[model samples]
Target: MNRLQKLTALDTRFFYWCNDLHRDLGLAPVSRFVSRLGDGVLYLLVGLGFALWEREQGVIFLQVGLMAFALELPLYLILKNTIRRDRPCDRLSGFRAVIKPSDKFSFPSGHAAAAFLFATIMSAFYPPLAPFVFILAGLIGLSRVLLGVHYPSDIAAGALLGVCSAVVALHLWELI
Candidate 1:
């Protein structure tokens, strides 16, 4: 098999194991709740709340949220269109995905990206909360894999991208 095929094959097995573990741990409800909280509306409200509570922190939240979307959305769109990786649910031999994926492509998970981006941004603002946010993000990322909606590599890349985006945004904010 080619490199990409090998990668996907590995991911398929990894995700299957994760799915089993999640099922064993009874993570369905928790995953669903976390996923719901990851939506744009909740993120906006949370950022606004932070902004209201602490003006400077609120600004950082707004900036980070905007920057994350600015970086992630376009990349998701482009890669989804270009890579067009099929969702595991669609494949007959693939793991039976718990969640219904909207699109066919499943290269880099938007959920994973958003989770890490928010965690990274929030950590920057409140260093004390770094561990909590990262742990949350890590759980969110694993949820995607557990649900069979994303490969482990997909989450990893998304996280890396998120970290890069957050760093860039912070540097840019510092300049302005």
Candidate 2:
């Protein structure tokens, strides 16, 4: 088979492996929690809380995180629509998603993008939190695949976009 075809096949297998492993390990509750965190509520509150305590730092955090999301969201949508990839649970036979998705397309997972975007921004403001935040973000991305809503490649793409969006947002904030 062609290289792209081979890659797709591998990605499918990886999805099944992650999904089954999560189910088998009985980590459904944890997976669900991480999935919800990617919804952006937790990050928003954290940023707002920081703002309440420290005006300057908080404003920077909020601005950077929001800007990153604003950038990530549209780019994610364009990629999703352009790719038109079907979610694993939707396309693969007998596969079921642990959580309901917000939308149909699933090339670059929105959850992964949001989680990574916040993680990147937070890391920028507080370098010491880099390891913790990134680990949490990584878990959120893995949760997407484990929940059977996204492929490994989808998570990768989302993470790449998120990091890039954060850099762009920071640069733009500096210019402004």
Q: Which candidate has the highest lDDT of all?
A: 2
RMSD over all Cα atoms, model 2? 0.9
- Screening candidate 1 with a backbone cut-off below 3 angstroms (N, C-alpha, C), the clashing residue pairs are 51-58
What lDDT tens digits, residue by residue, belong to model 1 across residues 1-176? Answer: 89979977788788778788898998888887776666557667778889889898787778777876798778777877887777777764835777787788887777777778888888888889899889988887777777777788888877877777777787777887
lDDT of each: 0.78, 0.90
Write model 2 residue lDDT over 1-176, tens digit each, in one string: 99999999999988888887898899889998888888888988998998898899988889788888899889999999999999998999987898888889898988888888888899889999999999999999998898888999999999999989999999999999
Off by over 4 Å in 2: none
